[model samples]
Target: MADVIKSLNLLETLKESIENNKLSDVKDAVEDLLISRINLAVVGDRGDEKATFINCLLGLGPGDDGSAPSPSPAAPEEVACYLNPKHPDFRLWDLPPVPSTSPFQPEGYMEKVKFPRYNAVFVTFTQTPHPHSVEVFLEARSLQQQTVYFILFTSAKDTEKNLEEKRKASLVALTSHGVSLPKVYLVRPSTLEKLDFPGLLEEMARDLPEIRAHALLLALPTLTPTLITQKKESFKALVWAAASLSGGVSAIPVPFVASMVDSSVGVRILTKAQSSLCLDNESVERLARQRGADPARLKELRTCVLSVEVTKGEVKKRLAAAEKEIATVSSKLVEMAMPRHARSVSRSFAAMLQALNGAIDEMAADAEKIMAAALGKGK
Candidate 1:
């Protein structure tokens, strides 16, 4: 059931590539041939370019003074989100990832480049959703959906009256497609800040469901199985992602048990002074639970063994070393757990990395099956 659903996602990716002329459906029929397995291989054009294309699409293209070859553009021609671990463009990078190379490279890039299977991708800007912008968004939504559905993200950029005027224009353009009703959100960043600034930042945050979607994704395991089952393998709409965030640790009593992970957080100072990995099973279990890992599912996964080719000897070695490494990482986590500004953010960020590691292990096993099949090799 999982493989079939995953393959359907591949079909969606293939369809977009075909329409864009990156691949010939008839020529690359292997992608479509499988009925029981998901195509883990990321087969698509350059998403970084697509990211840049998106930038250009949104009229934020390099802000080129035509200077310095326009900073070499982030990427070229596909559905780029963010594939690089080294990417430093934004202040906070909350997007998730898988192991990838040539993050700038097209080969095996699609699967590696994580994206929100957001049914409605609301792109909020200080500007109104113009007609051409609406058309671009419509096509973006159409390329992936069976019958075109999506969202419009905006900020109450002007005064209340002007905001209403822009909202009406955007809403009208968005719903203009009689076939769909777009999801919309107004950003308000001030929700995180108690201080006063020009209201622009608050206005932006008010409608920033897109940004929130990234944070929400980190906490996605909390989304009930029913919502997940309905969407199958796709990302929940930003609205749904937003809805699920209410289940995060922040939503819990005393916010993260208040002292459970923190009591040992100070060990980081000692560990950093000497370099160490001090977290233990209790800590990991607390964290794993905090990360929302299902003990039952992990047990089930042990039996499934989707992919693990290393010898028992190697597995033991990695397990031993990783055990040791966890102690060092744990101590460091404690250190950062205290920094005023980066405290929760860093902790959540670290927790996110841990979650990604688990997801990668699952995906790796799935990927190696196809990888071995393609390479004509076997364990």
Candidate 2:
């Protein structure tokens, strides 16, 4: 609730600046509001499986022969850290597996990998549990700063029965050591298609702190309908912020300047939504190609990528079309003797909000269409 209030206040401040023709102040506020980052650590003893899972999560396609190095059991000390390409702010740290033969002090192991600073950690396992990993999870639970954990079962079949058995066995092993478990997910690293993976992602989105949850949602690939819906809801949560920013432009004293600023703000909001939904040209093209879509159709889809110029043009066109309706209402208000300034500000605010709402709706629909086409549900 505090965060909500803070966000509202920030949005209002942004609106007030726009109303005052404070372009620099508006830019600064938008920059501050938009800054977000998330740090994630993947830990497990099966180094190869862990690498495969991380690669798949990043949409790097197992990376067996690609840029992402496949971790080998022989090199248990090798660690990889990189920002997710789709979301530069999402930092993923692949911690090397703790060798069973090495010293098994959980605190020492965690410190060795510098895991204390990560926002969230995923402990991966296979058919059997590693005693050292279980101990590390227990230690992690006791840390001064709370850390989110997801117990991942990698390189597994997608059947619910198999997943449940593996999850139960892992739980039993952890319980034997007096360790309470966090959420567990069974993932097939090869295909990244699992019955529970979406649920796991939803739980993470629901459970993590706000900033981290927002970053995670932006970083995730649109692999399932549930995930796509979650992305939409996450974007929807920011509409008020966008609308507030638009309404702020209404206060600008200069004629036409407020509308220009509103156009840019609308573009920014829609672009952010497009990126968060993974509907950018590159993502959509790659997904289409992978789905065996026709070459010409893929080319057509790529052209639908969101752009600032296009968004601005659309907003201007819509505003022009709405002017007649606004004029009719304004004339009625004038006959009632409403102040001209009040009527002008009302028209400007309405136009700005309408433009933003229209842009968001169009971008969301494009994202859904892309997702459907990729999933073989679209023409």
Which structure among the candidates has the greatest lDDT? Answer: 2
- What lDDT tens digits, residue by residue, belong to model 2 across residues 163-255? 778788777777787765545566766446455566666566545665466656656666665556655554544544444344443344533
Give the per-residue Cα lDDT of candidate 2 at 271.
Answer: 65
- Stretches off by above 4 angstroms in model 1 are 1-72, 75-120, 124-126, 130-133, 136-157, 177-179, 188-216, 219-379
State which candidate has the highest TM-score. 2
The TM-score measured for candidate 1 stands at 0.25
Tens-digit lDDT track of model 1 for 24-113: 331223211211111011111223422332232111223332211222343443232321111111111112222233233322322233
Error of 1 at 168 (Å): 1.3
Where model 2 places Cα greater than 4 Å from the true spot, the runs are 1-36, 45-48, 62-67, 71-75, 144-147, 154-160, 191-193, 249-262, 298-312, 315-349, 377-379
lDDT of each: 0.29, 0.58
> Cα miss at 31, model 2 (Å)?
4.1
> Whole-model lDDT, candidate 2?
0.58
